[model samples]
Target: MLALLAAQLTLALLFGPASAQTTGAVKLATFKGPVTPVLAEYIERAIANAEVTGAAALVIELDTPGGSVDITKTLTQRMTSATVPVIVYVAPRGAHAGSAGTFITLAGHIAAMAPGSSIGAASPVGSEGGELPETLKTKETNILVADIKNLAARRGEKAVTWAAKAVSEAAAATADEALALGVIDVVADDVPDLLRQLDGRQVIVAGKEITLQLSDLPIETVPLSGIENFLNTLTNPALAAILLTIGLNAILFELSNPGGYVAGVIGVICLLLAFYALGTLNANWVGLGFVGLAFVLFVLDIKAPTHGVLTIGGIVSFVLGTFILFNTSELDVPWATIIALALATGGFFAFAIGKALAIQRRQPTTGLEGMIGQTAEVRRALEPVGTVLAEGELWAAESESGPIAVGERVVITGHDGFRLRVRKLTREA
Candidate 1:
């Protein structure tokens, strides 16, 4: 170990100031955007990377408008149970650590923030999708409050008021306010400054005290790799919603017009993706039931003849179901998307119903059925039987009770043997 350290130092020295700045130094992990599953995986990967690279410490830079409660709690657990000391930093200008982010900042081995950054607003918002159930809401709030308070107490600080306020009142505080309230440990201008500030700080990691030696150390930005990037892409709200919509549409299209291989394959693929996202999001099954009910109603409206009345009911059900579709404890669903889908569903049904009704009501203009009730010309001599020209074709004709005359206009009264039964036209008739 001594020899390895000496060799590492030797390499750093030979490489001059550039490499000397980074040898056996701090590694950084950054968290931006929503508190998604990809972010959780990224943090785990960062911890693993730190262990393998033997980094002195791992600093997680965070900036978010909050995220899912379940994911946030999992991330918090990772931070609290980390092998290498985990430093959570709310960074840069104009960044906020709100809602679930507040808990994350507090759960770190050492919480730090940039001078202009802020944290708190620890209220439990829906999984960024829709409102949660009342029972779930109560249970989640109580549990999260307890957990955050426990983390705070273990860190040897006042946590009761702050944690309770975050959950109950949706409290928020600036960096300076957080430091004043002991919500965070330190506030620095930048990463280098943070390192300088954290050089002698003692933190408990894996239940052991580790002093951070980060002063003047070159920071290695350990970002999420390609696989992590792909996973993150999969967890994106837009992408997930798109998969969900495509899956739903495919299944609906299949149901509307059954026995198609292409639609089935596409539906299965999209549904698989949707299920993956739903699992990651910890979505509520009840919301899924609502969506299913909406689909059922939509199908019923299309299949049954309700004269568009069922279709109107279907639109209402669809809108409500779509809004309730993602109401879960773990993450939020996009409200705008739900609204758009409702509008789209209404439009598609309207157009489809209009076409179907028009087809039903259309006047027949061709074939034998079309010639009935049309006026005709007498073409043959008939004491009571004669040929008549009707619908641009001449055919044998007869009158039921009287003889018809030839070369006279007549009115078709009925059909008899591929021809029209007509009565001769009188003057002004």
Candidate 2:
């Protein structure tokens, strides 16, 4: 009886932890926007955590227009090889897994979509959103076709054919259509509905087949870290452009009026972040050059008297550059934002020029130069020199015309080392 008890205890010790781990809560993470490196890291972290906890499944609520191909490959490889089952759900009614997003959705152990959601449109385009050259297009399309076909092969031949077409022809499908084509496993209304439908469904994870018991499992949400969120925000084309503009202006201001380090420091930080976003988005160098030229023109307008001509040119260059900067099929900046920023920049420079012109035309207000043109009252009579009350102070003065009587007004013509040269004021009448 003691030996039997020992065997039972040994069996319990061997299987208890495994059972508990397999029955743990489900993990959910929401991913929205472009599939950049920051978001890639977030998804990787979530997958790792789910594997460590032995959760029932890791559900990624996906909403993206897609992004970098290299990053997409990295994400797909990670998801496919993850120890935990990964479910890619295109959710919240209107989301679509386009471009690189298509590969990521297909790489999931279980793919799902909500009503009105779509999938596909995985064709490759140039960094600037134009069609690739013939040679390059053929090469890229073939490789992508092969990769996507492999990912969709398990679904069926129809899915494989459709996946190839998605890469080659840029085909897309709605949730119902994808489900009918076997491209997706289910069309769920939401997370809860997804779990309910996926429960008892068997999926192959990391080469091991297991049934997902998600219906009864508690769901725990995993949110992006603060740094991740900030980096992700920097990926926005409009925001990045705005940052670049502000950074350049701040740096210019610091250079023009040096001393305080606040503008310089902020400029550096913003520039670095903007550059990061630009690199991630693959911005056109020509567009950047145009933007730089616009600022140069603005500075020139301030230094040289152009009467707002250069400012107008700068506004045009700025608007054109901004449009070109984000002229990609997937990344488009709003025209209103670009126009407004350009107008505001032009107005600011115009105001600065107005102030500069005013200063140039105004008379000096200090020192001997400032005292050259003033009216003074004679306090003492002078044959050639006398004391005069000038600028509310008594000063020794020499008369230029002739003898000037006391209380007579004189116009200051010049100064001679603490002495004022004056002439009698002629009555205008």
Candidate 3:
């Protein structure tokens, strides 16, 4: 029995628990990610799958640096009241249940963590990752304290304070401390060990404490689908920002050079996705406005020659807006992204303005300006000036040399109002 207990303890230390049964024993699904919409969706789907399969319970493997307080609460409720028992295991070494993760772990029917794992830090804040004001923080702390306390009440008060400290002081206790304080029920070496240790442990489930008979239960790992992976990838903050940039550029490009539906279509798609992501993550609208203002400055600079002053302002606004948009609690935006956008934006406007100036300096090619290079047949001969038919009308013209013949095609070198300034196309031609 001593050796058996030691062996069981080892298995619990690891998330890789042996199959509880040989066939049709239980279904264990896994999802490890941030608390994003896609993750929420995957959890909901896993719960549904567990119900359909008639499994004993579903185990959710979690490892996240808390996100969106609202989403955490929702996931907590689902775990606590799941029709099938919900086992939330904060698994693998070095994993943690910070902020929202504390609530989730406590809500589970059986909360367990691997060695070197931790849980705590359930403080709440606004969506932009800023600390809530003192008053709001107090209120938020009180609410979360009550929440975790209620869950911990059935377990113990020590667990309750630890839970609160997790959010209040950003406290984190190791797996050993957590188990000792009753914050977690078990600390197995791995999944099989967890099962063995839990084979007959009495725990309250749905208001009834029953020994879980999970021996010989087969465990199947349900992973996120391909579609879910794709959605999750798009939900990244950086990716969303990139999409926004691409979409905005595409639409602007199409506006400058119309008649191409492809750019417009892609722009619309990317913009829609960017809006959706920003909405979901609850981005600061002020930052968004700043980004808009930056673009406005850019367009204004393009239209009116500010001699690069507006362009400089536009670049500064854009860089600041991009940095502010993401709400980084860490090391701000990537230097590479900023450098690339600055170089690209600066080059774009400078090149455009240069091209416009070049066009201005070039010789005229339309209307009266085009009559300069043209040749015409003199209706009557003259020493210097004479009436000539050219450019679809008869005009008074002059030649520096001999008169030209009729029906000759000539280049329009210059134009002055109604006069036809004619010249031969080429000496050889």
Candidate 4:
């Protein structure tokens, strides 16, 4: 019994540290969209959680077309300095790490890609998606090139050169090409495969070199919170443009016929949401101005009887505005959708305003003015002024042609205050 106890103690001491090192779970998170502030927050939270939980490593499955540069910088900085090793994998067969995505992928301690996935295209453009002015473009491009070079340095000179070309010329590479160029360390088929490949890989984490023991570890997926999901949806450029259009039209409808607060409330809500989205997307203010002008023209057409001329101009302005609003190289806003929405909005307002004007031109149907051209029975003889039944009520009336006798029918020709002017109805012989 004494010998057995001594052997057990020796065995525990020999393997305990190795077993403890591999006990923690691996953390996983998916980021499949533009890089917005919400995405940055979510990643930051995930990293913090991993650190708190003593996770073996944090894996970020990324698929994005790109997004705000400032947000991307924030994410890269956080990821590069994280306590736990971060593995950025471009996954799901055909996903591409574009523009800002390139910076993030390179920032990871272990950069990887799935089979058939791609990376690169890190060119810097204006915030509004247009080419920057030459001098500014040079300055911004140089800054980005320097940053990317640093991120790719550990991968070797080939990767560093390719990364610079990606920014200067928008160069892209497939998974196999990236692996050959040393831009990525591995090409995996899926998450499980990624872990298998990443096992035993050495990575630098917070200034210390560590080997990943990721095989067979439990993976805990971190999902976006409700608020994060909602904010992510607001990052869509097309959705923002549509919201702007609907909000303007609704508010205009409420202003034209202001009674129920339903349209007005809905309009305000939609506009607020749209503004949030536009601000996130860095939409062109000139496009917003055009949209506002289009609505203004619509109101003018309704008020000033412009014979549809102003309405046509409003339609043109609306289409132009929508096009400009979503004109970003990072996002592909459908032209067909923009044109269709503009035409529909313009046609609806034109028809609505036309109907409203027609109603206004109609003769009065109920009031003193309504009594004109109406037939009435003479309740009392009219010696130029007498009481007569008009519209089921007795009214003092004056005869325009001559004195009207009692029990005779008379027609109201006009009204002065409450007195109606009447003329005896003549029966054609």
- Top candidate, metric lDDT: 2
lDDT of 4 by residue, 325-384 (tens): 756555745787788788888888879887978888899888998778989988889998
TM-score of 3: 0.81
Each prediction's whole-model lDDT (CA): 0.74, 0.89, 0.72, 0.88
Global local distance difference test of model 2: 0.89
Candidate 2 deviant stretches above 4 angstroms: 366-369, 375-400, 403-409, 414-421, 425-429
Q: Give every collision pair in model 1.
A: 127-331, 127-332, 128-331, 128-332, 128-333, 129-332, 129-333, 383-403, 384-403, 384-404
TM-score of model 1 (CA atoms) = 0.68
lDDT of 1 by residue, 374-408 (tens): 77877786568778888688888886547766677
lDDT of 3 by residue, 198-285 (tens): 7776666556555576666877777889988877776666676777777877787788779988999999999998887777666666
Give per-model TM-scores.
0.68, 0.89, 0.81, 0.88
Q: How much is the lDDT of residue 79 in candidate 2?
A: 97
Q: What 10-residue stretch in candidate 4 is worst by lDDT?
A: 15-24
What TM value does model 4 have? Answer: 0.88
Candidate 2 residue pairs that clash: none
